[model samples]
Target: MTTVQSARGPLDTADLGRVLMHEHVFVLTPDSQRQWSDEWDEEEQVANAIVKLNELAAQGISTIADPTVDGLGRDVARIARIQAEVDLNIIVATGVYTYCDVPNFFAFRGPGIIPGLDDPMVDFFVRDLEEGVRGTAVRAAFLKCAIDHHGLTPGVERVLRAEAAAHLRTGAPIMVHTHPGTQTGLEVMRVLGEEGVAFERVILAHSGDSTDAEHLGSLAEAGFLLGMDRFGIDATLDFESRVAIVVELCRRGFSGQMVLAQDAACYIDWIDPMFKGALPNWNYLHVLGDVVPALLERGVTESQVDEMLVGNPRRYFGG
Candidate 1:
């Protein structure tokens, strides 16, 4: 059986039961928070995440693939702290997150500075996968990069290419934060395809944000696993539309090519605390609490849900 790295340590893929393909224990802008936010309490945040994750484990979601990477302030040590308290497995990612520009850390150090020079991010990502992240001994289990409405800007392409190169070096899978409304997954299919990343080795995340079943179906047919993740963020798309897309895709016999998640984070500094009140259901429990019940009502079978929640993730981890 194949094994994948978790925040607690490595685990057999089969042990990753009823997986949520996307979720973040924390998502923050570290430098900004440290400089400006008084609400950034480390101890409290960790404690709160433990409580919430324990609640998630109670729902039978034994694993969550957290794609919080460099730009989003990923701290493996903090994750280890929470993983220690919870019954669930937290699989972290390694890659850069950028919709437009590469992080300043990567700006001038790579090939764009001068041709034929290898991009350092590929080695950095590979090291996080092979070795452990920043000496935390919590190795990353997957790669994450994004292509948003900004499209594949030069910086975005660089990060995506590095993730692809790292995937070639290591068999660990990839998760691309795609803006399906922009049809960015197609761009990913082209870029990653040219880089020799097999479609099965990648997940097109945030596919649920789009109501375009035809667009999602094409990607599934192309062999990429779709993350009908983001079940609770109804602000972008209403609850009914999100459920409808998943139902439609499953109707077309693409359940095996999909994975489910809420894309919720315990403490995200991205939104204003006042405004965060708008998304009440955008928490860890939305999938179990609401989405699944709605799906079953709409004719998505128990086995289809199992394929999306269990079988697909196991296969993605190479189980």
Candidate 2:
């Protein structure tokens, strides 16, 4: 009976037979859709999300982490409804995302950037965890934050600090959206370590995008969970290359800290209607049936797959 304890309660690892750590449920907003260049009606958007979730459920994926933050339409009520309908364990997030432009609310109140895990903001996150997400029945099981490619801006640093504060309060774990080949993941670990937060409680997301095996090895050695979540986005690099990186990392004796997911969202087309280019396949079964089998053919073992897909995620999300 493989099980990992989450802040919500104990989660059966068997229930999460195969899981995707980085994904979104329903994030439709004018600003978010600007990348797509067209407006979407709320009903259509919700229906699209339902279609995707149903697809995932049919493919044998038992759990998904929808890492959308507060302002990005992190609709907990809607997500809970979908979870009940689809019968999938949907873990949501509570934190803020980092962008070059700070929101007006943050700008008006600040001479300095607010730390993500700071006093009032930390209180807000803790309150959401204690009460309910967005005043709905769903509760956030993880804290999501981001670091830009160029190192932490003062604004991002504030958010990272706030994330750390939330970890201190709830011990729910933190997930970072990092730029590939950047040291921002390392920097996040450094800050969290300084704050007395255990490295095991932080997930360095998108670390696989970088071919720098040494950098990833170092983070894994430091005890942070490494997220190789973007599996099938092949325009920049093919699936083989991504699996090669994971295989290489395992060869270097760092399999213990690795996790895998496709990170494909159906809304990519909505976000960028101009992105008519080939998109990675979002079907979870394709990954489990095809991608994993291909990796196995390339000499990657079932154990390594288990480490990346099951063990590391179970540990990071506390199952």
Candidate 3:
């Protein structure tokens, strides 16, 4: 059986039904939360995450592929605590999420500064996939990294290569935070391809942020799983445009190459709370409660939606 690691334990890939490919239990700045925020209650946040995730499970979502890695405040122990209560699977990742510089911890240790040393990130990420996260037995099911509008800077290149290497080592799939606006997915294809990583093994996240179906179609044609995720984060691409793109892609017969998600977190302190309140539909429920219905109304078939939600993810995980 093709088994993907979950927070609870190993899960047969066939059991990963109706997955949200990109979601976070929490997206935090640990330093900011520790020193600046006055309202972070540990127990309350855990309880809140439990509530949010359970509600997602009630929607018939069998799994959530959380890409919350090192830079995104990945607290697997706390996630483990929350998973004990939720009914669905929470498959976590291992990688650095940096658009620019590598974290100080890795700054001078890798080849970036040392010139001839192996990237410690590869070992660390491999350990997470092979051994377990930190000291827990919950192995990471996938690898994650990013390249934004900043393009392939040295730091971003470092993390991407490390993640690609880890994938080649462990056979874990990778999700890259890409900027479709800058046509960054093309750069991602070039980079990971050079590292000998197959395009099918990589997910170009946030491809839905741009409505340029030609660019997205090219990436999909190239065998990259387009993450038509980020539904409900309307400031970049509004609800109608996001749903319309999916319908358009499905019409073009690329439903098998797309995946859906809200990319929602229970509490992400990135935006001001006041600003976050403006994104009324930016939650775990928005994709199913709103986007899916919208896609159906726009003439996308239920089978196509299932292909995106179930088949694509299962294939990506080697089910």
Best by lDDT: 1
Q: Candidate 2 regions off by >4 Å?
A: 1-14, 31-38, 110-118, 280-286
Candidates in order, TM-scores: namely: 0.99, 0.87, 0.99
Candidate 2 lDDT at 314 equals 77
Over 20-55, each residue of candidate 3 has an lDDT whose tens digit, in order, gives: 999999999989889988767889999999999999
lDDT of 3 at 304: 97
Q: Could you tell me the TM-score of candidate 3?
A: 0.99
RMSD of each: 0.8, 3.3, 0.8
Candidates, ranked, lDDT: 1, 3, 2
Worst 10-residue lDDT window, candidate 1: 107-116
Decoy 1 TM-score against native: 0.99
lDDT tens digits by residue: candidate 1, 1-319:
7899998888999888899999999999999998988988889988899999999999889999999999999898889878889999999999999999999877889786986689999999999999989959899999999999999999999999999999999999999999999999999999999999999989999999999989999999999999999988999999999999999999999999999999999999999999999999999999988999999999999999999999999999999
C-alpha lDDT values of all predictions: 0.93, 0.72, 0.92
Report the CA-based lDDT of candidate 1 relative to the real structure.
Answer: 0.93
Pairs in clash, predicted candidate 1: none
Position 297, candidate 3: lDDT: 89
